[model samples]
Target: MLQLTDVAKSYPTPQGPLFVLDGIDLRLAPGESLALMGESGSGKSTLLHLAAGLDTPDRGEIVLGARALSSLDEAGRADLRRQRLGLVFQQFHLVPSLSVLDNLTLQARLADREDRDWTHHLIERLGLAGLEGRYPEQLSGGQQQRLAIGRALAPRPELLLADEPTGNLDEGAADQVLDLLRALIGESDCALLMVTHSARVAAPLDRCVHLHHGRLADRTP
Candidate 1:
């Protein structure tokens, strides 16, 4: 339920304005998954930020469902993010002091939509049943990442935006995390837009698109 049309983003440099995304067009429907692939400096994160409304694009529009992000003020965007969007990143952004259960329910509680059943389901499904009282530092890397993913999903968001979600883990752990992620997304019928550089990481997604020269180039692999 996300769409980007004629999107272009640039930043000022000593030389001149450096465009990172030029006329980028992409769409992710509900229950669909997309992998955004690119080399460093290809603007994959920029595009993800635009879609998440974390940063505004210099031009073009990003629409989440029926809402146009360009029309929203910062507060509105934050509200939208809280209610409709779930975000995961390479670095697990867990609160160090909060218990695993608290972290998982934080966003949902903030949105005033915490569902205990769903939260408990997330805990069990994420393989975090016995570790509810533990803090982020107490868990292993994979466990921490799973907790992060669970936290993001606790709110039952319409869309999940992940940037290098498995980057910190070993290959085996990364694959395991990806499998769990896709399974959870499927069970919830949530759309996924994951930004990653590895083709292997992108391989399990429904579609993969490469970002080249500030544009999206569709590729089967």
Candidate 2:
């Protein structure tokens, strides 16, 4: 459902342009999960951003489903992202003022695709059945992360892009979150592209790839 071809990305620096990704090619099919691994400054997050349509590649094409991302204007991209892509970040970007239920349903509401039955199912599956009335600050770290995951999936997005989604949690919490995430991904049949530095985090994915010096290579294990 997602593909990138001969992608290159660079940013300006004092000396010249600093290349982040060069000649990168990758693909993920529907209901497939791929883990992207890289050291700091290796452009893992950059690749995720490009794939999510949050940023454009300097060169090469990004195709989601049948549409070319480069063919879309900013507003078009925004609309597509809102309607089809789900994003999760390390920060657990939840709205502090919104209750857990509200936060969970926010994206679905925005997309005008809210499914009460599915949202309720997610709340139960995420171990958040009793915390719907609570706010972000009122919940534990793991609870907050689970709530974030629920929000992302509430819209039933076609593709889910996660950047170090478990980065802020402890090992136990991270493991729990990953399990829940994987289960939900499977249930929804959404394609997942997750960027993580830990081998443990990438282990459960269907395929793993490493990013180094602006390119991708298959990673076994």
Candidate 3:
């Protein structure tokens, strides 16, 4: 459902141009799970941003469901992102003023595809019951993270991009969040691309690809 061919990104540095990714070639099938493992400064997040259309590559192309991202203008790319992509971040970027239910439904509403039943189901599945009226600040870190997951899945996106979804939680909370995410992803049958450093976190994925020095270092067993 997603493909990257000869994808490369670079930035101007004080010394010279610094390459963040070079000759990246990746393909993800529908409903597949991939874990992107790398050290700091290894460009995992940069690659994710490119895949999500939040950033454009300086070379090559990113194809999502046969649509080449480089060919789309900014507005078109933004629309594509709104319609086809779901993003989960490490910070749980929930709106501070909105209630949990509103936050969950925000993106779907924006995309003009809000489903009340699905929203309710997501609330229940994410263990967010009876907290619909509460603001994000009122919830615990784990609850907020769960809400973030719900918000991402509320639109039933074909591709879900998660960056360290469980990074901020305690071990028990992290396990709970990861289990919930995995179960929900299975239930929805969406392709999942996650960036995480922990082997325990990456172990559950279908494949793990390690990135180093702007290139694929190893495809682990």
Candidate 4:
């Protein structure tokens, strides 16, 4: 569903251009899950952003589904991201003014694809059944993360991109969230490309790759 070939990215610095990703190649098929493991400054997040259409690489091709990212202008990329991509980050990024249910359905509504049945199903599966009326501030960290996951999946996105999704929670809560996320992703059959630094975080994924010096190598079993 997502493909990156010869991808390279760099940014200007006082010294010179600092390359973050160099000749990175990756592929994630439909319904497949891959964990991207890297240390800080390994370019994992940069690659993720490029795949999500949030940024363009300096070189190389990124094809989401059949459309090459380089071919799309910013507006076109935004539209595609809105319609086909689901994003989760370390921060919940919930609307403070919106209730749990509204937060969950906001993206779907924006995409003009809101389905009540699916929203309720997400609420239940997210363990947010009785708390629909509450706001983000009222929920615990794990609850907030679950709500974020529900919001992402409410539209039934074709692929989900997550960055340190459980970073804010304790170990117990992180496990719970991961379990819920894995189960939901399975039920929806959406491909996943998650960036995490923890080996434990990458263990359950179908495959894992490590990013180092702007290159990718499969994690040795």
Q: How does residue 90 of candidate 4 score in lDDT?
A: 95
Task: Tell me each candidate's TM-score.
Answer: 0.98, 0.98, 0.98, 0.98
lDDT: worst 10-residue window of model 2? 212-221
Q: Residue-wise lDDT of candidate 3 within 116-209, one digit each (tens)? A: 9989889999888999999999999999999999888888889999999998999999999999999999988989999998999999989999
Stretches > 4 Å off in candidate 2: none
Worst lDDT 10-window in candidate 4: 212-221
Global Cα lDDT for candidate 4: 0.94
User: What does candidate 1's lDDT look like per residue over 1-221, in tens digits?
Assistant: 99999999999999999999999999898999999999998999999999999999988989999999989999999999999999999999999989999999999999988999999899999999989998999999999999999889899999999999999999999989999999999988899999999988888899999999999988876
User: Per-residue CA lDDT of candidate 2, range 1-221, in tens?
Assistant: 99999999999999999999999999899999999999899999999999888899999999999999999999989889889999999999999999999999999999999998999999999898888898999999999999998999999999999999999999999999999999999999999999999998899899999999999999974
Q: Residue 164: error of model 3 in Å?
A: 0.9
Q: What does candidate 1 score in Cα RMSD to the true structure?
A: 0.7
Candidate 2 TM-score, true structure as reference: 0.98
Error of 3 at 52 (Å): 0.6
RMSD of every candidate to native, in Å, equals: 0.7, 0.7, 1.0, 0.8
